[model samples]
Target: MNGEDAIRAVDSLFASVKNADIRQKLGKPHTNAGEILPAGVDSLINSIGDIDDQDIFLDVGCGLGNVLVQFALQTLVSKCYGIEVREEVLIHGLQLMDETPSLRDYCGKVAIVCAEASTIQLAFERPYLTSKRQGLSQ
Candidate 1:
């Protein structure tokens, strides 16, 4: 699918889940549980330039995996990881991924982890970053 089509698909999937339900699930009086809209996703993809299949994308504080899903649909990034602290929201996001038929192919590439972003240590290394560091050392 193209960028616009991918954005529309993601937007529709996210729209299926109501904000009220998210707020209720969160049960926080003052929580900033907002997602990047389609426009923002478009702008983000543009700003990020080119994404290769070997590139890994990490979305810190990825709420509902919207951006991750979008990236999977819109880009060639092989692995997309979303770190979220709230288990409740993470559960919802996982359910969305599982239940959405369109996401079946991309789901394998996406992983939503329930953990504090700052404390989590990702095991995988980015090939581009590693090569860049090697070049610097040489």
Candidate 2:
């Protein structure tokens, strides 16, 4: 499924969305998440402009998980994972993947974790980083 198939799929998924709220610590700035248009996602990935599928993608606050899904489905990355603290939002994303068999096909390659980012161990022992890929953030 190359071409603009992944983008079209994501656009379809978001078209059926509703409002959702996320909890934040008291007094802290209200954390707001924005939806990037499918074409914008394509442009962001295109800006990265990787020549090969060697990048490992990780979206810290992956609200609806469109970026990770698109990355994996579009063949832009070798592996993709999203860390979302909200269980309901994460469930909503998983349901999208379940409804679409093509997205489900990459279940092994895509992961969505419902947990606070603080709980995750970012300091990995493996050599996932390189001079070319200095950091993993999107």
How many angstroms is residue 90 displaced in model 1 relative to the true structure, after the best TM-score fit? 0.8
Best by lDDT: 1
Q: TM-score: which candidate is best?
A: 1
TM-score of 1: 0.82
**Per-residue lDDT over 1-138 for candidate 1, one digit per residue giving the tens place of the 0 to 100 score:** 578988888988777788765564444554545767977887889887778787889988887888899898989999999898878888888888888896789877899888877797766764455542334542
Candidate 1, residue 119: Cα displacement in angstroms equals: 1.7
Which regions of candidate 1 deviate over 4 angstroms? 24-33, 123-128, 131-138
Estimated TM-score for each candidate:
0.82, 0.76
Candidate 2 per-residue C-alpha lDDT over 26-138 given as tens digits, one digit per residue, 9 for 90 to 100: 77665547667777777777787763566778889887788887787676577888998877778877777778765576655678898889889966665554536656643
- Clash tally for model 1: 0
C-alpha local distance difference test of each model: 0.80, 0.72
